[model samples]
Target: MKPLLALALLAALAAPADAQERSGIYQQGEFIDVWNHRGGHVLQMVQTREQLAATGRVVRIRGYCRSACTILTTLPNACLAPKARIGFHAPRIQGTQIIAPYVDQIMGSFYRGGVRERWFGGWNRSREMQVISAREYTRLDPQARFCPSLS
Candidate 1:
């Protein structure tokens, strides 16, 4: 009977996480160059942010999130991991260094807190990657907090 009880506990612990547990967390990962069609990228980010906002889940940023992924920092439920690093840069048209002001304007709309201020302050103008640690970002954006994990 004791062995059976131990086996049952082990089985329970091994069970797959439910949707509430899985979708509740978003792991911000590495790169994918959205070289062109930045307008489409902006649209998708807005839609994703809206859906995530409605879910009441937590978006945990980890590792290095670059380009379009940085836009998700706008999520109202966003949480920054201890080692989180985010990269930012101006949107450029396909195959050129020319900055896309209209696309960048849409991207800027997603930011709040000091992030928005910084965006307007010219972080968005960098042609090359501009990286910031989670702590620095949190300092600029008070809405985010340090959270490597929920517990």
Candidate 2:
């Protein structure tokens, strides 16, 4: 029983590592091109979000952007590679028409916390941006002007 339990625990610990996807960078000319080497494109958003939040730095990731990936792009620091396959379509309505509200909802989240927009849905802006630290995030709530997370 003890040996079996130890094996189970080890497997559990190793599971996430196995599940976690990673990107590979290849030297292409003067640039280091990054590609999803493991897992699916969906993991890109989750990992990038966590990494940016923890480090509070600019992040450049490449992958197909659509569906849930759109939601993940709400992170202020997100930048989609120009060649990435980015597609946005409305959710199916009844059988034929597409729902417009889905676009609004996705864009709304982008407005709420992600990018600051002088005009909505304008591609003229660069997606590359910076994330506010925990201190800056809380400055909105005058009660907590200082966040220990900033330290």
Candidate 3:
């Protein structure tokens, strides 16, 4: 679908801001928290994407979203804010520095094309978190378009 058409559809189907917020839906200004250090479980993130996909609601990444939260990028209905920053790092086994292949596999399954090849090229291999701004991320993955003006 055309970008504008998708945005228009979201606007039309979207519930009121307060209600949307309460229901864990994106409403431009608000964000879905996916912090890195919090290290949300990989399987849990898979479930998150499934749930959000079922809603057919637009998921916007505003402000900071890191780690497993970035998995939401796989959502077909996802969007990005101008100031968005997404962080990634090697998924480590809890309480250890060892990289978790299972976690990487799950995350890798969700991310493909440029997202898997370039963004995670070095980023996911390091324990150090790497962040890409909305501008950079858009260049890397054109599928993630910027959110439209609702007003």
Candidate 4:
């Protein structure tokens, strides 16, 4: 019985970190409070990635940072805001397949940028690598005008 109980405990401990449902407004002193909320489903949000284009200069984003959101943040004009709480983990795809390239690029960029590992402590047991392997997207063209959001 003791061994059985130990196995159960290990299984529970080894379970994947479930995606959380969280929503809130993140405020940074550089500007007004940027609004944020959960969208689509858990572990996801509707970020105004298109809005970054309009800012022209570098724009920092603060939110419940994770895979999808991290990719969104990689857009040329995007930067991480001080208030951002990043969930440093591998990006999920469809439902199961983890996209390697995307994860490599995201994690590589973060590592190069000197992001702390403490930011990613929650991802220890995940089979997905913290790094993404993806092609680099084009940086925002200085001369290109940002189109407005229709939604």
Error of 4 at 47 (Å): 12
1 or 2: which has the higher lDDT? 1
Best of the candidates, TM-score: 3
- Relative to the true structure, candidate 2 reaches a TM of 0.31
**Error of model 2, residue 135, in angstroms:** 33
- Candidate 2 Cα deviation (angstroms), residue 127: 25
Error of 1 at 91 (Å): 1.0
Model 2, C-alpha of 64: deviation from truth (Å): 1.2
TM agreement with the true structure for every prediction = 0.67, 0.31, 0.72, 0.35
lDDT of 1 by residue, 1-151 (tens): 3442343345445534552222112222321111111222666667656755654656666556666677767676776667667778887776788888687788888777888888778878888878888889889888778764532
After aligning candidate 4 to the native by TM-score, how far in Å is the CA of 102 from where it should be? 5.4
Q: What is the TM-score (0 to 1) of candidate 4?
A: 0.35
Order the candidates by TM-score, highest first — what do you get? Answer: 3, 1, 4, 2
- The C-alpha stretches of model 1 lying farther than 4 A from their native spots are 1-40, 148-151
Q: lDDT tens string, model 2, 18-102?
A: 3224233232222222233222233453554454444443333344444333433345544345333333333333344544344
Q: Which stretches of candidate 2 lie over 4 Å from their true place?
A: 1-54, 91-107, 111-151
Alpha carbon deviation, residue 78, candidate 4 (Å): 4.8
Candidate 3, which ten residues in sequence have the lowest lDDT sum? 30-39
RMSD (Cα, Å) of model 2 = 13.2
Looking at model 2, residue 65 earns an lDDT score of: 42
Clashes within 3 Å, all models in order: 0, 0, 0, 12
Report the Cα lDDT for residue 106, model 3: 74
